[model samples]
Target chain A: MKKVFVLVLISIFFLSVLSSLMGGVVNIPLKVVLEVFTGKVTGIERTIVIDVRVPRIILATLVGIALSLTGAILQSLFLNPLAEPYITGVSSGAAFGATLAFFFYLPAFPYLPLFSFLGSFLTLIMVYLMAKRNGKVNSYVLLLAGVALSAFFGALVSVLMVKSGRDLHALVFWLLGSFSGRGWSEVKLAIPLIPLLFIPMRYFRELNLFLQGEERAFELGVETEKVKKLLFFLSSLLTAIAVSVSGIIGFVGLIVPHISRLLFGPDHRRVLLASLLLGPSLMLSSDLLARVVFSPSEMPVGVVTSFFGAPFFIYLLIRRKN
Target chain B: MIKVHDVWFSYEEASVFEGLSIEIEKGEFLGVVGPNGSGKSTLLKLVSGSLKPQRGSVLLEGHEVSFLSRKEVAQRIAVVPQEYHLEFDFTVEEVVEMGRYVRGGKGEHILEELNLMPLARRSFLTLSGGEKQRVVLAQALAQEPSILLLDEPASHLDISYQLELFDLLSRLNRDGLTLICVLHDLNLALSYCKRLILLSEGSIFAAGRAEEVLTPENLGHVYGVSAELHSHFGKPFLTFFSPFEKVNEGLQIHIICGGGSGSLLIHELYHRGCRVSLGAVNTLDSDEVIGRKLSLPMAVEAPFSPISDETHKRNLELIDRAKIVILAPLPVGPGNFKNLLALEKAVYLGKEVWVVNPDFKGRDFTGRVGEIISRIKEKARFFSSEEEVLKELENWAS
Candidate 1:
């Protein structure tokens, strides 16, 4: 049953990737897209399929993998079902950092991701420090601090938007989260973070033990404090990289793992593997909807994701109560 | 083997243990018992290497536990916590497999050993309290540790499940596992653990065999209650009584009871602060159990034997000292016909003689026992129940 589910998820992911490449503005035919891949087509069709859609798809896939893996790790680390990547203020901090970069007229290539990484990492450190009582981190305090710091950084980003003159439009689009106009450079930025995903995969057993509780995990031979610190760092880094490249895509990080767990079970080994596939499939489908639903004028992919994610999340909450 | 040597530990300003030391032998079934806040759980944590003592060492197999890596410690010891709350819906087999984290294996044998194979696929969150605890125990056992530590694992279980759990633990201990369990139920502790460590206010008050460590005086001093230790089926059993405020203090009440009829009346009178005594209760009788537990001055005779003249004389002496003598609704048999004779003597002494439920319709085993009851009817006050007798006593005292 698990293998069938995995196979189905992989197929849906491939279908979503192919459809995303073919269903964008100026809707290229599948034959043309395939021919472009085979080097038999050229000019605008080739550029549209290769230069524009391919990197966007790859960036979307990487961001999807990063966010979903982050959500899965955070949920287990905090022992909270509702934990997600941005639950630690990483997305808002990255947005504030990107807004600062744009406000200062810094180039978008490397400086944006670097500043975003710094912002998210600093926010994580601050939350960790605030939540530490004695030498141990209290997950409840960490959650509260993350939420409070997220709102604070969000307010700072809004303030930066209000003061900016020429960057207002760019800030708004980035804040709403879109993968439009991104190419290989952003994919290049996210490729380094793929290793971060594998680090958490190695700790699947530790993550499984964490669902019982921290004390139980420790008694069961996990170096709980060290594992928590390492996983927290990796998840924050993944969130920062994903947010920096694609802006704040909502619910992919929050819902992908949940969907995977609902399809599979709660064992992190299968959940992480399922999330790796489902995250990209959901992102690609949501991005495809964002493009074709509005035609030449695209809706922000974040908006499209939220459109589906909010109701699905509400359904999950209601079902869990029973 | 584990040795906690002079462990000085505290949580913030509240010190839990001070200069506490205990050594447990291999293959020993030891129970850690105490009142709340006596550091039973803390001792388990220290030995498990989850908590380090400030000024002492917890040595496992002659190695300092705090210095060992978590995997090394877990390889030797497995701890079953009080409660396990899972946020995710992991199945029982997955949970038990987590026990093999330090030492990797399938742990299928552990599942079969714990009888969890039937529920292996069930979600842990959907299990009952007893089932969840059993799964946790299976998880701990999957580590294949030589020593097992439990923190009141059966506190949340039903009475039957509690016994089932301890029976399983005892079986495991008999299989050469060193079991150190912290138990809130003293009876459960006494029944299973051959040795006991009694803690009071974070210190070891007593430690030895169950009989030596769980004495009535030790239990009374630690729990602030009057306790009695009795042996049943060669196991120590404890009964406790809260020290009641003196209501009828200095009032002597003699109860002429046999069979199990006088147990409740004796308990009520004793708890009400009356100086209660018993008369001519046969050994091993149900009433005799209560009388012996309370340590009340009483006259006793061999079971099913006729009340001897010496025991009847002793019963008369007890009745003579009492300000009030009450006849319990005990059946009159030929073996205990002397009890009716003692009640007549109480009437003659001018003491307040009360007969509780004098209707002995089917209870008269001796044909002539009812005739003696008629002789004392003029002087004896009749009440329907023990409650009525106690109310009348309260009224008479005022």
Candidate 2:
């Protein structure tokens, strides 16, 4: 209950902050923007606030939530303190997919989502197959294999981009990650897996048993491979959805769960729950700041997140050591 | 109940056990002791269902163990391995709680009985080896298993904990838990075990009550040591005596025994292995136990025993195989005078004769050693060291 309150409280806070910043008298005057927000104002003001900023903020929040949950699950899966959602070849594979899409001279490059989705899925399978020796899967082997394949796929992605001749700027932007193209369409695409992802998130105690080792868990009557497969399928689907909409957002999925763990402990129950709630709140607020900072010269939401998240991640690491 | 029938196990090229069969009844505290690579640990693994036997099967409580799912097996039997390298820093409470993993629930009583309640919240990895061992035992007990398989569980424990652990196990057994333990300590086995099984070269060499099975002869043959089996308050124990040594002024054994094979038999007669002076050969000869191992001063001839010390003293020491006489046809002759006198001394002492080998075709003696052999022949019945040797020589036939 207290956790929910904290999440709700942060959500309302970011919502108000975003609304006030986008139109409040500093930009379009408080009364006008307030009126627009309340359906009292007429014409362009209503269109701008409701259609533009609201959808983007919601998208940012949902993406953030996805990234954080994925990060938390990945960490415990490998029993590695350094593992993150992106570490499993998701981002790089998605980028490779997007780069391939850009090369085809296809009418709608937005179809890049399909390419990145496939790339991510392929990388995930490669990692699983490489790590599963006989019937056993070792964490170090999985991590190393994921890292190597992700790098190799990333190089292939870069080569594809270089061969294509249609203004590299657009392809580069998509590869780096940004929330500009996301609206209700992308938002709708990402939310369906929220329920699927929540299934594993609810079973953190089982995940804890798994961390003890499969042999022990199996002795305890846990169907360990099933649990791992479920986690893989759910986390990958959610990651693919997030990457599909937003080019290849790094650091959010990598760092959010770490912060979640620092606050909520290693128990996936609390960490995943907190992640689901806090992610959107943090990502939404960052998008709001990205929009209003140095007005008229829009900054990519990805740049804003890195500037904020990277320093905070380092601080958490050092502070955790202390 | 544990039944291993015709089970075969090996590590790579070396076969530890093949077609071996044994049955252990419920609540039986069975002690399994063996030489290295003799299938002691392998037997435990097979019974625990931790390893699959290449041939035949293991039945527990009249059910096939290998076919049971891991959970079902874990619920039935608890296995405590020798090494405990727990990576997670779980508290004692948490560690013990894992034992109930098979129950898919919890058992608070098992942890408390192991005296782990006080250390419940203490980190498991931080504890000393003894403490960790207790915690591990607590975890296994937490399973509340009907049968327990412990493999060298006391290897890391100090003497105090070793005894304490065994006491706890005995108490558990008294409460009707069946235990099968593989132990290297013979005395500990004799003291605590209701039955003892001695394994040699991956086969059951001896098994019965400690008093019945752990005889001096059995120890000498199975463990290759001429040991003295001791008993205290009706509980049998084993302590070795070194071979006869002139240094002690006891029966000086001019062992006609050859080969490094007999070293352990001679060693058990001494301290550690045994305490006995050696004789009847050059210092370099392998059969001279103390002469080769302990640098004991022996009446050894240069190179081979000369007619005086070599053949003669050898014949004299042959008298030591028996205070009576042991006619080992080491071809006695004129040069082996002292050996002949030694045999005469055995006859005079009225000691019995033990013929170690009956296969050698030597109606012979040349040196003093050979002379001693011929003299002892009438008194000792020549027999090989097989089951038949004791049967043929139980009463001094000569």
Q: Pick the candidate with the highest TM-score.
A: 1
- lDDT score at residue B392, model 2, on the 0-100 scale: 44
Separate DockQ for every predicted complex: 0.77, 0.26
lDDT of 1: 0.87
- Candidate 1: residue A275 Cα off by (Å): 1.2
Write the residue-wise lDDT of candidate 2 on B1-398 in tens digits: 78889988887778888789999998899988876677888888788776688898899888898777767888888877666545545678777777776775556787668777788878787899999988878878777789888878888889999999999889989999999889988788888888888898889999998767777778777766556565568766788654432232343333444334335435533332223344344445565634565554344655554446445545555454534333333444444444446546766666665556654455334423444457666866566663343344333222
TM-score for predicted model 2 compared with the true structure: 0.66
How far is B193's C-alpha from truth in model 2 (Å)?
A: 4.5
Error of 1 at B154 (Å): 2.4
lDDT of 1 by residue, A153-260 (tens): 888988888887675776678788889888888888788887777887899999999888789999999999899888877877788788888898877877998988
What residue runs in model 1 are displaced by over 4 Å at the alpha carbon? A105-111, A125-147, A320-322, B126-129, B158-164, B258-263, B278-321, B331-350, B362-369, B372-379, B387-398
Candidate 2: residue B83 lDDT (0-100) = 60
Candidate 2, lDDT over the whole model:
0.66
Candidate 1 per-residue lDDT, tens place, B141-259, comes to 99999999999998999999998999999899999999999999998888889999999999999999888888888988898877778778876698888876567877899999988
